[model samples]
Target: MKFNKLPLEEPVLKGVQDLGFLYPTPIQEQAIPSVLNHRDLLGLAETGTGKTAAFLIPILQFITNSPNNKVSGLVLVPTRELAQQVYQDAQALNKYCGLKIVSIYGGVGKFPQTKQLKSGVDLIIGCPGRILDHMRDKTLQIKDLKYLVLDEADTMCDMGFLPDVNKIISETPTSKQTLLFSATMPEPIRKLTKNILKDPVTIQLGNLTSAATVAHTAFPVPSGLKKDLLLHLLDKTPTGKVVIFTRTKYKAKQLARDLSKEDYKVTSLQGNLSQSQRTNAMNGFRKGKYDLLVATDIAAHGIDVSEVTHVINFDFPGTTDDYTHRVGRTGRAKQSGQAFSLITPEDKQLFNQTKKKLDIEIPLESFKDFDYGIFNPSTFNDPIKRNSQTQSGETKPKKPPHFYRKSAGNKYRKDVNGYRRSRSSSSGEKMKTHTSSNNYKRRVRPKSKSKV
Candidate 1:
């Protein structure tokens, strides 16, 4: 369906057309009407299904009809990569509508965001952490916020942002149109909606386990041999731009360095990167300055680069749903792509469970000359378990969510420093929500819901 016919304002319609959006994806076709109708929405969609545009089009329409030029619509995302992505899409779609959109997040200068707040912006897209920072400083004000959107709600909840998100919602007026979109409606997201939304219209895009366009595969290589397998596949596979998904920020950087060392164009995205550095990475990646991008789940949804030929999972993700989302980076928009994982013995169970969750058989691909026995538990260096007794005293990761110390030190202790388990890492336990970062929910009528 064309976006113009979805109860959008003339200017918003013009803007959508100007962006060359002639058709709507399955999620957009269902969610847009609900949003334009001002109904609270709960939606689920796969990545690269034009989800951002789904919500942004209606937001632009509502705002265009009553342009506040201030904080009228607010989009809350989980990471900086998503913040930029949502803001960039909103701006792109509303370029002809004269709406000011600002992306606010930390790990960079705050002055520019503060300045934008002062000057006034029609829509604001941001991560919960940085937005709270601005709010605390009294530099960013949203007294006039009308629409409150929680994109990737499951992720926010997983990142332990439920408390922080509650505080942010408290800051916004209760009499607001709330939209919560998640790939999976976890307990936290369900409860969050119960507190915030008023008779929300729920749209389930069916029980689709995985993206049909992506062909999944798991190569049962030993842990130590992951890099060699990745290199071999990259050299032989017919790939467009490729994305190498890792478990941690350190691993992402290390992989990028290793690949770059082999003269392969590469970059990485992680929380450790400053805003400018991240911008550089995304810009370079999108512009084809890099053939492979090593990233954590942070960029999984936000990245919408089309025709990604392959998705390489160097490490086993924590959840089966995450496995779906990670591999979803490719084979989008009806294009076929491959998802290959370098699984070790420890991941054998996970690999089995993941296939069950995806409800598809993942044919194993064996390496001709690669030896997996060395990278297996017997020969691979065993990781050490650190004694981080908390103040009752429990241990937690001192850094990123990926850093974790498994009790079975023999398997995970190789580089225990990064995962020297800390309490903070516990709070930031990764959630497995995967949806297109570009999605937006709009409505024209309220719909009924079914009980779970």
Candidate 2:
């Protein structure tokens, strides 16, 4: 229930207290002890359920008790963002312990990381690619690894790094403690577990691949008007940290730019930016430099900021798994949170799948007369039509066409010859034929008769 009763070291307890962690979430409550006891664990918990702390806390305590340079613990994450996050947490919590932690991920030089390895670190927190690089060069050794953690396992598999992960694991001692974590357990993950983890303790929270704490809602609107709806909601919402999830890095940048132009202090995270740009954005967000954070899903991993009151899904994520991770940004650490999705009519089916996956109904809320200000549904029915439909099964009468049109049955009025002629009721003018030439002939015949 509490951090103190979990058999953690006194130093870790002090750090946890300083960090204001009182009660453990479901995953933490179950997984911490297993990790502390040095048992292999396969934990299935949604993001933001304290999965990081579940593994990190114990590893820190263990390394604090005994430390070495042969990489005592190895954490394999799926993305650069997550690797940095784990490294930061380890560095922070293990500050007093004097345990060295190195973060190795792509987008930078191998020389620096190799140089860091030469200096000796007790732990290696890295992405699959960089870790594989070290293994290929025989520069890093994990044979002495006592703790091996696969964080966000499903993501790793999705990114097509399972072979790399397996190779990295093979380099380590088979007797090492393996901790595998995933948000969803697809069949591949299950098979990977069966082959890799040995008689592991299993812990799961919420429905599979879904966050139970997050309240989900979708506002059906046109894609073009999504920005307007986002602004309106931000203006109307209560003050707290907010994360806006965009589908692409370009969208993330554009969203941040537009929001900043609107005079709202905001930050952005994406793949294209350099490491410094990412660091600045993350630090700004964590230090309250900006209350609004716009990011792509890749940048969103390992962002464990607190007091995030809302998560706005500016683009409906591609899959239910992604939706779970996006919403998990909020409702963290037992705090209440709300996630709103701006869905187009095309995304309705995806929204419904999310609902079914999450096993909950999230009703759409309307601000009457506001039309939510920006979102216009493709199938938007008139309020009058809605009222009539409620009374009868049919929609209300259709108004006359806005453009002028003659009656449908008049071929003379609609065909090619009708353009120069007048109708029977149209000013009651007589019609003239283009081929008639009798006027000049009659005048000539009268002249001829006078001459005779």
Candidate of highest lDDT? 2
For candidate 1, write residues 189-255 as lDDT tens digits: 7788888989988877655455787777666654545676677666656567788888899889877
TM-scores, all candidates, are 0.80, 0.80
Query: Residues 292-357, candidate 2, lDDT per residue (tens digit)?
Result: 899998788868886777798999999877887888888887777788877765576787787777
Off by over 4 Å in 1: 299-301, 369-452
Find the 10 residues in a row with the least total lDDT in model 1.
436-445
Whole-model Cα lDDT per candidate? 0.73, 0.76
User: Model 2, stretches more than 4 Å misplaced?
Assistant: 371-452
Sliding window of 10 residues with minimal summed lDDT for model 2: 414-423
